[model samples]
Target: MSLLDEKQRGAILRALHDLRRAAPARPGEQYGAPGNGSSLLLSLVTVGLVFALWYVATNVGWIKPLFLPSPQAVWMQLMDVASDGFADASLLSHIGWSAFRVFGAFVLAACTAIPVGIMMGVNRVARGVLDPLVEFYRPLPPLAYLPLVVIWMGIGEGSKVLLIYLAMFAPLALSARAGVKSVAIEQIHAAYSMGASRGQVLRHVIMPAALPEILTGMRIAIGFGWTTLVAAEMVAATAGLGFMVLTASKFMATDVVIMGILVIGAMALLFDLGMRWLERRLVPWKGKA
Candidate 1:
């Protein structure tokens, strides 16, 4: 082999030997290769720069500490949280409640949305019924429904869940609809020509093609849920991070507020990363555009 080919061959040989000595993949398995270290380093560097800027900006009072807390104070709060017995409850406790609310709404919306969206996309009658309602509700803010939700469900977890659901539902429904509609016309026709049933067409052609867009919608919906949580938790939550931020506003504890905001941002980023990973795995052809 030439030099480049020899290098590739050597790498493959090494990989094979490593695999032979290593543990086998579990059922339903794929290779667990190392990820892009350069990209990981770049992300770490970006975060470091952002915190440096934040630290400098707040200390110089370029931005009011009321709005932007110092990095040191925020770090102290994080240390407090990590050390134990912080925030009247552990940080994880608050995070657990918040995650429960977000994911509950997200799951509820997705369960209803994916099916409704598929029906709307694949069936003209269903689409006719759904199109007008989605159009009417899509533009309305989930916060706009807060009053009605409270009146209907009380200012309890039920109402909060409803608000999150409303926040997440519309974008996802639209995405599912788009995905369904984007299924190639030729594929449907070909399936029918092959004497495939309507169900078979849906299963084999529409769902597979539409998964990427559906996932895209789900991601958007989750983001909206995150955005809506501040308002949602404004109701009667006593211990959520949202509540912590809201309460800290009175004491002007900008450090805690900033930390809470950063926590929310980190959570959102993590969820987005997870969705992107799922998208890539589920739709290997998604990045073609």
Candidate 2:
């Protein structure tokens, strides 16, 4: 307590307080600072009003039934989720299959992207060699590869996983590269001055410096991956929510179509939540994930 002046201590305390409070949301908002209950209530109220509008619009036929099913119709369909399976696959099965495909490809991307990105960061020669190729493929659309990927890999699980892997891999690699590059030159010098080896410097210094950027990239990649994953499933999948939605549309089972849409949305939300959890766990420096 006596080591610092009172004024300096006060400033430090304030800074710590602000840092601790800087979470994902504002006070009272969902995932916000600890004490902002008002914001949380407001968020809930807004969602409720949206639901109310939706219920009213459908029930009163303000919108045509074809265009917008009433809340009752949607609710009935949702209830049947437990009662009637989706396209011979239970709602649970659809979610499970979709999650499996997305996560499987995501794991592959992470494994391949991280090591190369780290190497790219530490080795100028590697960067020169890889950067051009990475940039070339990075801008291409993931679905653009569908035709060739199917041609090369066939329309089985291989094609589906390959599509998702392509969609997720480039962004992750770029992010890892950026993270590697963002490490301070002086930190590398300091490590060298301390007799640290190149590999050791990369592991202990460059990596930590680049971690924040990497996490940022991962969040973006995961979001892009989720969107592309649906398209992948739509192409040929028989069990995923996207397939169910496509099949339901063929017969105009609009209720089932809506249910599938909701299921996809729910799954996406769950993934986003999982990302938040990971961010919080891995990057405590980030405000609430």
Candidate 3:
């Protein structure tokens, strides 16, 4: 009962596919596409230009070495720190310590904050109770409460972890709450019509919808955790990248300071990349309109 022969139908389908392939992605659609290679090349080119400029500026003495050490000097300092150690510990040890504090606090915050945020989104009472507290402290800088944290928890690893934890908690919680609230009412109603229980609805409907936001929150929370690391390590910290950088500054080791900064930046960037990969794996539909 076909209106046309197989060849005509096949030709129409092929044309439709070609049209789709040629179409540009709309805004808030695909996160990446086949053309990503060009974008990556541009990024690499930009980085190369920046480094070239830095090299020229330093070698030409356009900028003082004190303010900005040459990239060569920074690299030499990195090698020295890696092999001979810095601030009474190897570079790896400092990195390990800093990672321990940042990631431990990050994990703790994610575990606690996400659930609280979900509760806040789902229940007015929970929202009422926690909203004021989260809002009150979130705007305060870590330095503002560092002294209080030290006084209460003492200058131990516990205090450092807690400091970073507090920094991350608010953002994660808020993001999760926002994610839950963003879930469409129609989705909930559809789930309910299918005889889904409250628990099932949350598990299947709300959680998936909210996952993208929660993942985004985790990314933000980790950044906050890293930001708080230096403040945390300031409290009686013998070994950490933050401590090393602080110590080096006292001795006016600009190269060491720059090296530490680069190392930290690299680590943070790696974590962000990991988060992005996870987001793609868990919610490939994200960014779609």
The better candidate by TM-score, 1 or 3, is: 3
How much is the lDDT of residue 121 in candidate 1?
87
For residues 131-229, could you state the per-residue lDDT of candidate 2 as single tens digits? 888889888987787889889988898888888888888888888888888765865675566555566666666676677777777767776777787
Cα deviation in Å at residue 84, candidate 1? 5.5
Show the colliding residue pairs in model 3: none
RMSD of 1: 11.3
Point out where model 2 deviates above 4 Å.
1-43, 287-289
Q: In terms of lDDT, which candidate is stronger, 1 or 3? A: 3
What order do you get sorting by lDDT, best first?
Answer: 3, 1, 2
Error of 1 at 124 (Å): 1.7
Candidates' TM-scores? 0.82, 0.79, 0.89
* lDDT values, one for every candidate: 0.81, 0.74, 0.88
**TM-score-best of 1 and 2:** 1
Off by over 4 Å in 3: 1-34
**Candidate 3 RMSD to the correct structure:** 8.4
Which sections of candidate 1 miss by over 4 Å? 1-45, 82-87
